[model samples]
Structure formats: C-alpha cells, structure tokens
Target: MIRLDTGAITEIALLAAHCDDLAIGLGGTLLTLADSVPGLRVRALILTGAGTEREGEERAALESFCPGADLDVRVLDLPDGRTPVHWERAKEAVGELRRGGDPQVVFAPQRDDAHQDHRLLAELAPTEFRDHLILGYEILKWENDTPRPSLFHPLSEVVARRKAELLMKHYPSQRDHDWFDEESFLGLCRLRGVQCRARYAEAFLVEKATITFGGA
Candidate 1:
C-alpha cells in the first residue's frame, strides 16, 4: 500500500452523533496527532447528550484523547436516534462549525453507519465541509454496521492500551452496555492492525482523496 502523508495538520474537525463516539472511533489517532502536532486545534461537535452526565463524560474523554491541543467541544441537545426528524438543526449545527475555521481534516461517522443519527451527521458533514478531507470513523456496535475502511492509522502499543483505559475510566454511563469493554475495543483495533500490518490501529472510510503525482 502506498502511504500518503497529510503534512502538519494544524486543525481538525470532529463530528459525532453522540457522546463517546469520537473516542471510540478515533481515540488512538487523536492521541497520535496531538502528540505530533503541538497546539493543534480540535473543534468537536456532538449531536446529542447535552446537559447530561454524558456531556461531562465526553468533555473529559476528548481532553484526554487530545492532550495539549486547543480542543473546543460542543454537545447539542438533539434527540438520540431521532436525527432525521431534526435534520435542519443538524445541518445548521454543521454549518456553524464550518463557519468557525478551515480544518485540514474532519473525522465523522461513515455514511453506512446503521444508526440513523450517525448516518445523518455523515451525510451532512460533506455538505458543509465540501473541500476538506473527511475520514469516516467507525463505531463498533451490535448492529453489524462496520464498513470496509479505506484508510488506516496505525497505533502504537502504548497508545492502544491508553485509549482502552481512558474509555473505561471516563465513560461510566457506557459501562452498563453489553458491548462496552476493553476486550471489544482492543480486539477491534487489533483486527485493524492485522489488516495494516501493525500492532494496533484505527480504520476509517475515505469516500475520496486527491493524490498529486509530481513534486511541488
């Protein structure tokens, strides 16, 4: 596989349908990026779980994931699992995020996600950030919605373990869920690592990417 380097990503936009989505999908990658690029600007938008314990969990979780970076998080009050009904609000939220700044890359839910809220945010992301590279992160759930990802970000053993640990520690609300555990999270990362010849990794679906053949 030919690797393409996204040089010096100073800003990143993170979009999610609910709390814990970003951490579950791209926690390791966020850790790696923040370490590599000091003062990286992270603007995160979550569609649901505002004014609840989940919101606090999300803030703490993202701060842990993007250490030393300028992280700005906004958790909205949209109804969970009802994104389609609040389509206009979702679009407006995305638009407001787009107006803030231009980011080199965006991490969002994939179009094929089984969750209605996730799918709606995925569809709306591209409409606002038309020219940016949008990597669709996968959230492993019981719905069997994982897609064959086109992009891979290899994670070190340290980052992988830390990600699992942070998830368990910060998100108490998710503990009761049957699928929330270190084994499941690490197992998924290990599987992706196997796909990309690494110890552990996070995978993303890229709908399109521009490749420049010649030197600048």
Candidate 2:
C-alpha cells in the first residue's frame, strides 16, 4: 500500500457530538500530526459536555494528544442523545465554526454510527466543510455501529498504546463504561492494523473527497 501525505497542511478542524469521541476516534492521528507538523493548529467543537467534568477532561486529553500544537476547543451545552431535537442550534454552531477558519481537513463522526449524536454531526460536517476533506471517524460502543471504513491512518504500536493510555488517564469519568478500556481500544486498533498491515491504525469513512492530479 502507498502512504499518502496530506501535503503541507497547517490547520484542521474537528467536530464531535460528545467529548472523548475525538480521542477514541482519532487520538493517534492527532498524536502523529502534532509530532510531525510543527505548530499545527487544531480546532475542535464538541456539541455537548460543556460546564461539566467531561469538558475539563476533554481539554486535558486533547492537550496531551496534541503537544507542541496550537489547540482550541469549544464545548456547547446540549442534551445528550438529542442532537436531532436541537438541530438548529447544532447546525448554527457548525456554521459558526466554519466562519472561524478554513481547515484543510475536518474530522467528524460517521453518518452510519448507531448513536444519534454521532450520526447527526457526521451528516452536518459535510454541509459546513464542503471544500475540505471530511473524515468520518468511528466510535466503538455496545451498539453494532462500527463502520467498514475506507481510510486507515496507521499508528505505530507505541503511539496506539499512548492513545489508549491518554484515554484512560484523562477521562476518568468514562472509566465505568464497559467499552471504555485500554484493551478494547487496542483491540479495534489491532483489527484496523491488520487491514493496513501496520501494528495499529485508526479507521475513518470518507463521505466525499476532492483530488487534483497535475503537476506544474
């Protein structure tokens, strides 16, 4: 398989319906980019979990994942499991985020995600970031919602373990959840790793992509 570089990108935007979603979905990717790209700018907007311990955990987790990078995060106060009910506010928030800056890539939840919150954000990402690469990420949960992703960002074994470590260390509030453990995180990464022939990888689904093929 050929490794495709995103080319000299300096900014990226991330959208998640909840905290920990980004960490669970693309922490390794963040870790990789932050380490390789000097002064990378990462902007994140999460629809829920504001004013709670989850928000604090999210800030810390992202900071840990994206060392040596410019990181900004905003968490909105919205009801969990009811993103569809607050469609207008959610859409507006996404729009506002778009107005803030133009990122080369946008990471959001997958449309086919079994969770409504995840699915809603996934659907909304393309509407707002039309000109960018919208990488829809998967979150593992009790529901059989794991997607057959077309994109795989390979992670080194160490980075994959570091992602698991950071997830467990930062989000203690999610510790009780049955699916929120290092083993499960590594398990999924391992599966994706087999597919990509790497020790580990994070998978994503691409709803749409634009490519240019000519060299001047």
Candidate 3:
C-alpha cells in the first residue's frame, strides 16, 4: 500500500451524532495524531447529550483521547435518534462550527451509516465544509452497517490498547452495552489492521480529498 500523509494538520473538526461515537470510531487515530502534532486544535460538535451526564462523559473522553491539544467541544441538546426532525438546528450547528474555524481535516459519520442521526449529520457536513478533506468514521453497532473504508490509519499496539482503555475509563455510562467492552473495540481495530497489514488500525471512508502528485 502507498502511504500518504496530510503534511501538517494543525486544526481538525470532529462531528458526531451521539456522545461516544467519536471515541468508538476514531479514538486510536486521535491518539496517534495528538502525539505527533504539538498544540493541535480540535473542534468537536455532537448533536445530542447536552446538559447531561453524557455530555460530561464526552468532554472527559475527548480530553483523554486528545491529550495536550487545544480541544473545544460543543454538545447540542437536539434529541438523539431524531436528528432528522431537527434538521434545521443540526444544519445551523454545523454551519456555526464551520464559521468558527477552518480545519485542514474533518471527521464525521458517513452518508451510508445505518443510524438516522449519523446519516443526517454526514449529509450536512460537506454542505458546510465544502472545500475541506472529510473522513467518514464508522461506528460498530448491532446493525450490519460497517463500511468498507477506503482509507486506513495504522495504529501502534500501545496506542490501540490505550484507546480501548480510555474508552472504558472515561465512559462509565456506556459500560453496560454488550458491544462497549474492550474485546469488541480491540477486535475491530485488529481486523482493520489485518486489512492494512498492521497490528492495529482505524479505518475511514474518504468522501473527498485532494492529492498533490508532486512537490510545488
């Protein structure tokens, strides 16, 4: 596989429909990126779980994942699983984030996600951040919705293990879910790693990106 890197990612935008979505999907990638980029700026927006325990959980989880980075998170109070009903508000929130900063890369759910809320935010992401590279992260769930990702971010064993540990540590509220266990999280990472010839990896679907063939 030919490896390509985004030269200098000083700023990133993360969008999620639910609280633990980002951690479940891209925690390892965040860990790897945060370690490489000094003073990285992370702007995150979640559609639901504001003014609740879930919101607090998200803030703590993100801070743990992106250690030492400038992390700014906003959790909206829009009803979970009913994002389509609040379409206007969701769009506005995305727009506000776009105006707040121009990130070199954006992480969001894919359009083909089985969950309605994820799909809605995925649809709206490109509408606001049209000129940016957007990577669609996947959430493992009971539904048969795992995407065949076009891009893979390989992870070190330590980073992969740390991602799982942080998820279990920071999100106590999600521990009851059958799929939230360490086995499930690590299993997915290991499988993706096999696909990309690594011990562990986080895969993403790239909807749009610009590749420069040679030096300027």
Which lDDT values do the candidates have, in the order given? Answer: 0.94, 0.92, 0.94
Task: Tell me the tens digit of each residue's lDDT in model 3 across 99-214.
Answer: 99999999999889999999998999999999999999999888999999999999999999999999999899988888888889999999999999999999999988777888
Q: Cα deviation of 58 in candidate 2 (Å)?
A: 0.6
Instruction: List CA RMSD, all candidates.
Output: 0.7, 1.1, 0.7
Cα lDDT tens digits for candidate 2, 1-216? 766667787999999999999999999999999999999999999999999999999999999999999898999999999989999999999999999988988999998999999889988888888888899998988998788999999999999999999999999999999989999999999999999998899999988886666741
TM-score-best of 1 and 2: 1
Stretches > 4 Å off in candidate 1: none
Alpha-carbon lDDT of model 1: 0.94
Per-residue CA lDDT of model 1 for 92-135, tens digit only, reads 99999999999999999999999999999899999999999999
Determine which window of 10 residues in candidate 1 has minimal summed lDDT: 207-216
Angstrom error at residue 65, model 3: 0.5
Q: Candidate 3 local accuracy as lDDT?
A: 0.94
Candidate 2 vs candidate 3: the TM-score winner is 3
Query: Model 2 reaches what TM-score against the true structure?
Result: 0.97
